[model samples]
Target: MHTVVCIKQVPDSAQIRVHPVTNTIMRQGVPAIVNPYDLYALEEALRLKDRYGGRITVLCMGPPQAEAALRKALSFGADDAILLTDRAFAGADTLATSYALAAAIARIREDMPVDLVFAGKQTIDGDTAQVGPGIATRLGLQLLTYVSAVGEVDPENRRIIVQRRAEGGVQVLETALPCLITVLEGLNEMRFATMADMFRAARHPLTVWDREAAGIEDITKIGLKGSPTVVSKVFAPRPRTTRAELIEAQSGQPNDLADTLLAKLFTKHPQLGRQIVRRSS
Candidate 1:
């Protein structure tokens, strides 16, 4: 029951800024943290490890500084950490990222057969929600997205049941082993890292792999070259200038309050009152 969890190091959205001239994100002086959504996926994997007593591997693809993200995962009790970093992987979009990750996971499978893979529903920075599905398709694994709960796992029979959140209602899904799941938020709470685990995480030697080590055969299928998406512009939304209006009821009763509110609303916008009268008629 070996599990692999994918995480990303992203700039804190609250501190993010856009370059006015370049129309790109200004990462300078911004702090980096693990993607919040990925934490849910990691927690789910940790719970599975606790139940099945299997090894858990944390994987990340980013710059060398992204090692901090992997170490954070280690502190949370992951058994192993792997960082995929290379100059050739620069400027990768979701497509290229999934391709590289899929290739690296294949390399990992060579060493130890992976029973399941887990990832977040989406990244805060990109918010595209495409990479997980892309990885699943590349690896020919069962794709499970928006998973709210993992119900049962029969490792002996390679069968697993999960509760998926859909637009209409929750769907109970049963799939075989070697599946990839993109977990939604609030799936489970992350546990606090113990002092011993923190010490171990600081001293653990991470396994870093370049493109060649990650078993990437085609150079044209990774990095910016493989990415077809283009960003035309990046900017902040305009702030609203309108202010809220307060309505006071003299009687301080529920009916009086409602009447006052409706009177004020209709007075401010007569068209609304006309529309209501027409509808009633």
Candidate 2:
């Protein structure tokens, strides 16, 4: 199938901290893990590989440290790993990131033609859900996001079918080859890595490419300059000071409990009580 799965190394959310004064992410002491959503994407790619007997390439764009994420993918049985790292790629927003990734994928195409590109619906840190679509737009690939299930892949005919999650229901979509998909979470369970796979991942020669190697000719299209979005400020949400108001039923009866809660709610918000009554009518 010649699938490429895009992944990222993100600070573990549970261990992430915000600077007290600056209110920016405190990444110094936080441990980095592969984005959980991307794991699902990788698992989907692996499933496709198992079915079709094709190569799966794990791709990542981050600092040198992001090779850890690529290694993790290799342990999961990916055929190859590529890390695109450069100082020029620093402070890149989704736009710049997609551009760099599309460029790298183009470089990969020079050797082997890619049939499908996979990515998470969104990164845990960014959560913009834009990069996949951006990459598809830049590469002129068919865009499919929030895919809940993959139906059929006909490489001979160059067509694929997928179940996409929409606002009200699922939409079955059939698209041409060279498509980019952003897979939704909870589609399938991830397989565990075997001992041999672990060892192979440890000894795997990761392909590391800098900006020039990745075929980024325009300096202005990468790094901070390429990113148009800017964060004016970051702040922690204010903690609530008020305590929960407990509704105690004197009788220990379900009806009594409901009555007590309703009384308290009505007392607190008379307008809400009137609205509820009007709706019932």
TM-score of each: 0.87, 0.91
Per-prediction count of colliding residue pairs? 0, 0
Per-residue accuracy of model 1 over 1-281 as CA lDDT, tens digit each: 99999999999999987887776788889999999999999999999989988999999999999999999999999999999999999988989999999999999999999999999999998999999999999999999999999989999999999999999999999999999999999999999999998999999989999999999989888999988887666567765878767666888899998999998878988999999999999
For candidate 1, list the clashing residue pairs, or say none: none
Residue 42 Cα positional deviation in candidate 2, in Å, after optimal superposition: 0.9
- Estimate the TM-score for candidate 2: 0.91
Q: Which regions of candidate 1 fall more than 4 Å away from where they truly are? A: 19-24, 236-271, 274-281
**For candidate 2, which ten residues in a row score worst on lDDT?**
230-239
Off by over 4 Å in 2: 238-264, 278-281
For 1-281, candidate 2 gives per-residue lDDT tens digits of: 79999999998888987888888787888899999999999999999999998899999999998999999999999999999999999999999999999999999988899999999999988899999999999999999999999999999999999999999999999999999999999999999999998999999999999999998999898888899998787678988989988778888899999998998889889999899999999
What is the Å distance of residue 120 in model 2 from its true position? 0.6
Cand. 2 Cα-lDDT: 0.94
lDDT at position 245, candidate 1:
70
